[model samples]
Target: MSGVVLNDVIKKYGETQVIHGIDLQIENGEFCVFVGPSGCGKSTLLRMVAGLEETTDGAIRIGQRDVTRMDPAERGVAMVFQTYALYPHMTVEENMGFGLKMNGHAKREIQTKVAEASRILQLDDYLKRKPAALSGGQRQRVSIGRAIVRGPEVFLFDEPLSNLDAELRVEMRVEIARLHKDIGATMIYVTHDQVEAMTLADKIVVLRAGRIEQVGAPMDLYRDPDNQFVAGFIGSPSMNFVRGTVTDGGQVDVPGIGTVPAAGLDAGREVVVGMRPEHITIDPAGDTHRVDLSESLGGVSYVHLLGGNDKIVVEERGDYRSKEGDTVAIRPDPAYLYFFDAASGQRLR
Candidate 1:
């Protein structure tokens, strides 16, 4: 119903600070996702928003009210966690209505809310089944249905699909995306999986070492990352980094990938060149690199090659016939090349 805002939020346990000062705003009906590697504090930040974890410093406002110190029940946000946390003995209908029942809502009101949530989640046929009778995805949907019954101001998902199998993860991603479209509710999701973040988020917050790294729409982050950390982390197969030297003639010299004019950098400076796998083309007629491995997945193939001491991955669509142990040459798109400061790991602009 309303937006959420964090003002210079900080979190610490004892003397160890896990979440540094974080300032973020989630617009009404926006799907914001917090993503990063393990121990990066993405979950900690989401829990802070849910009131499940305390904000050590700064303010958290949900709509117009400051909810930094509010109890989880008073925050008007429903959180679906990594674990299902369902009652084994309760039927799906009962489970969906349990929260309202515990709050002393009338039976009719609970049933009405539960029925609406059931219809939204397509759980009508399984309402009479207990947790023991439902499949993994169904149980997870019931878990989400429980949250939907609360009619909260915001929805928080803490890697809710982490427990599902590969196929179910994809299926639930569609379901969750559709749920957001159907409800138009503000949702904050946390995940270590960038694919989920890329496919689901209206905006993504990338975090590392208790601090916010970058925040933007998925494609924006992928196409124009602020630093090498982001450029490498946001894409699948990761970006390739190779040692390069800015030559006296204002050209960047890279082994195996050839030379490109430097982007206003001083001569004799060292830099790191980044190339995305999809932007690289393998030359079967030339031999400058050796194919370390090759994997074909239907129409797309990932060819891993060893260029000097650097490892490069080349993504080829349709029919790519590069095999392991072949001596091949690779070329990166000049327009897609990214240069970063060798010392600081920041983009060279």
Candidate 2:
């Protein structure tokens, strides 16, 4: 296994440039995830590292060797795409070993590697079954097994579980994480799913508009986001933003909600107050807002409230339930509040 390094990488298509200058380093054996909204260049960046897409400028290095100009086969990386891409006529065992066979390995060598991969992926019983006989998860495991057989230095996954059902996606996520731990291989996974990135990555790279927004551990990005985009994108329920203004005593006054501390700001400066639903405390006794909707999901309930033109969701657990049209008040935890520049969406310290 080897590390990957990108120095000022850029990608362009004819006259239109898509990926801007990107500098990144993936340590050997690190599991890095590239994540963002759709068409944000996450897949394109992964392809650049895999030698599938042409790099418009800058250099790509794998281990100690420069691989920017290297062929896809010579880059020593294995890519598992969203589609299974397995041969229909071949059995699972044949499919897993086909790459080795094509590479001119002896039959015994292919069988040995295939057996090892099957053991890792728990495909011993399904080895004789064809693609038609296997489940979607099993076929993907076989696809992954083929990559393991090649012994690539870096493993690239392009939304490999997108086709699976929710349960299967979760199951495969555990399996993939375990595979990385057991093999200690360097891996780069691309996905639009922030949940997957949070659960699987040792390092998460957040990208937007052909550039990196932030890079850190999943929880680091969640807790200390540098901007409004990172804060809203990293969390599952997304952060809520409300208009606020700095007051005479350095406090921010939220129109519908009460005043909170801003400490140091010009008297009339505009700021966006951010609050997470989970951190808000709902006071049913106080009539500041009205419940617009309530979605009960077993142990947790999301209550949407409306006050004038402002709308916010509050997560509740325990005995209290806020039905539609019920009067309520919400107090966001002062320590948990984040303030951002209204004009630029930049986090304000």
Candidate 3:
């Protein structure tokens, strides 16, 4: 019953609206991630849920209680920010218990809560250590432990890993995922990195330009995207697109490559054909493709090709590395092909 529900929620600054009408539901104990590029209103929407931003229209319900106008502390949620925001003057234990002390909690009660949080985060050994004595990952874990001690109904994270180095970011990602599994609390995380969203979230909310583009399970959105934008945004290296025109025989003819069978589309219509890099293979017998560059990553390689006027990327494994300026024919798997309208970018089928 502690699930979150947004009924046509909206936000505006002055005369300009940032968040469009958005309706969403997040179940209790679910880890949902909001992911999109910069200036996409993902953070804005998250702030509204945190009660840090006012709703220009509609209502926000948390655990069946209306909290649209509630104070941040009254919303039954704890937020972790990109910055650790720890107290340098205090030890980890003191910093974790400071909030409860200020709230008039008894000394023994505060100590008990801090001890439990420290144990859960494996910071028991560092309880007496100051912020300066801890590493970046350890400090971030302390920040999370602070939230855990509060025992909020919902947990909100806003780009919490952005401040860490690449290696620490990966480590923190695993830590946070494991924490979610242990706590089983309703959590909402926001990040611009789709890879984090894919790996950490039970459900993902993809946003763009102040509007939600799509929402679904990670693999569901990856395997069956609703539009070109979602398909292009969800995957690493992105999906390749080439302009084409539909033919009379239910096929789409790319200007540089041959025709591809795409049933269920009208003839003579302008469209864009999409394919993933993994679905493309080099055809040694064909002569219309040229390898522009090859990126070797040990077990896998990505070969960038120039076919006619289009640039396509193909993934190769083992001994299929093609050098720059090498002539190669690249073919896409028709079974995995995607088609979209030229004007609207909507999926054709």
Candidate 4:
């Protein structure tokens, strides 16, 4: 029942407002991720929840307690920062039990809790090793182990995998997912990486400039975004937007490409046709498009195309490959097309 709730939460430093009033409910045992570009206040909001930052103008409730003004130690929440933040002089076991030691925990009790955390993180073998002796991934596990030893009601991760290498990031992502599955604890994670958000989060909160843009399940946001920003931000290769004008009989006229059938819109209205890269294919009989470059990555390739003043990337799978400077016809699937108002950048039904 230890769910986190933020009601009209706002953060500001004097007159410079950063996090606007954000109201959100993170259910118990839910893996909620606050994801957005840098300076979007994702970390700030997480800090506010952790009691590391003050909630300037709203209520923050963790479980049944109103902890808007509570001290960090009294919040009953554990935080794992991006850095390992481990003590170089102390072994893994010592570092993991340091917080409990300072809190006047019994030596036997501390050892028992540390042992359980070590088993969970698979750090049992590295208990005797110092931070400097362990690898980056192992060090991070030590940090997480420290938090686990606290036995807090909630776990907060602030870009915990950003410090790892690409392969280690993947490995740790799997490890964290497994950890959540095992404990089923209420967790809140913050990261700018969309891949991390998509893979790790049960609920994704997309933010922009201190404001919430969208909040939903990962694939839900990817398949049906509320606006153009969410549509463009959630996907790996962003959605392609081509400016066009609505023509006769509710048909949208794409520049450099011919008219496409679109209903429920006024004629002669300016709009942007949104198409995901995966939905578009190279058709020989389709409109001739210029291929700028191709990024071949083993199983798949992303073909970059120059369409008028914009750049569009198409994901090609299997044996299909497009060379640079090749003229190909780009055909977009009619069923998957998305329409947005050109002026407001809002999705059009």
* Per-model TM values vs. the true structure: 0.98, 0.98, 0.97, 0.98
Segments in model 1 whose C-alpha atoms lie over 4 Å from true places: none
Pairs clashing in candidate 2? none
lDDT of each: 0.93, 0.94, 0.91, 0.92
lDDT of 3 by residue, 158-262 (tens): 999998999999999999999998889999999999999999999999999888889999999998998999999998878999999999999999976789998
Quote the positional error of residue 109 for candidate 4 in Å.
1.1
lDDT by residue for model 2 (158-231), tens: 99999999999999999999999999999999999999999999999999999999999999999999999999
Error of 3 at 145 (Å): 0.8
What is candidate 2's TM-score against the reference?
Answer: 0.98
Model 1 Cα lDDT, one tens digit per residue, 1-349? 8899999999999999999999999999999999999999999999999988999999999999999999999999999999999999999999999999999999999999999999999999999999999999999999999999999999999999999999999999999999999999999999999999999999999999999999999999999998999998898989999989999888899988789777688898999999999998888988899988988887888999987879899998865579999998887888998889999999988
Error of 4 at 5 (Å): 0.7
Superior by TM-score: candidate 2 or candidate 3: 2
lDDT: worst 10-residue window of model 1: 316-325
Tally clashes: model 1: 0
lDDT of 3 at 106: 96
| Model 4 Cα lDDT, one tens digit per residue, 1-349 | 3899999999999999999999999999999999999999999999999999988999999999999999999999999999999999999999999999999999999999999999999998999999989999999999999999999999999999999999999999999999999899999999999999999999999999999999999999999998999999999888999988887788998876678889988999999899999998786444467888999988889999876777888989877688888887787899999998998988998
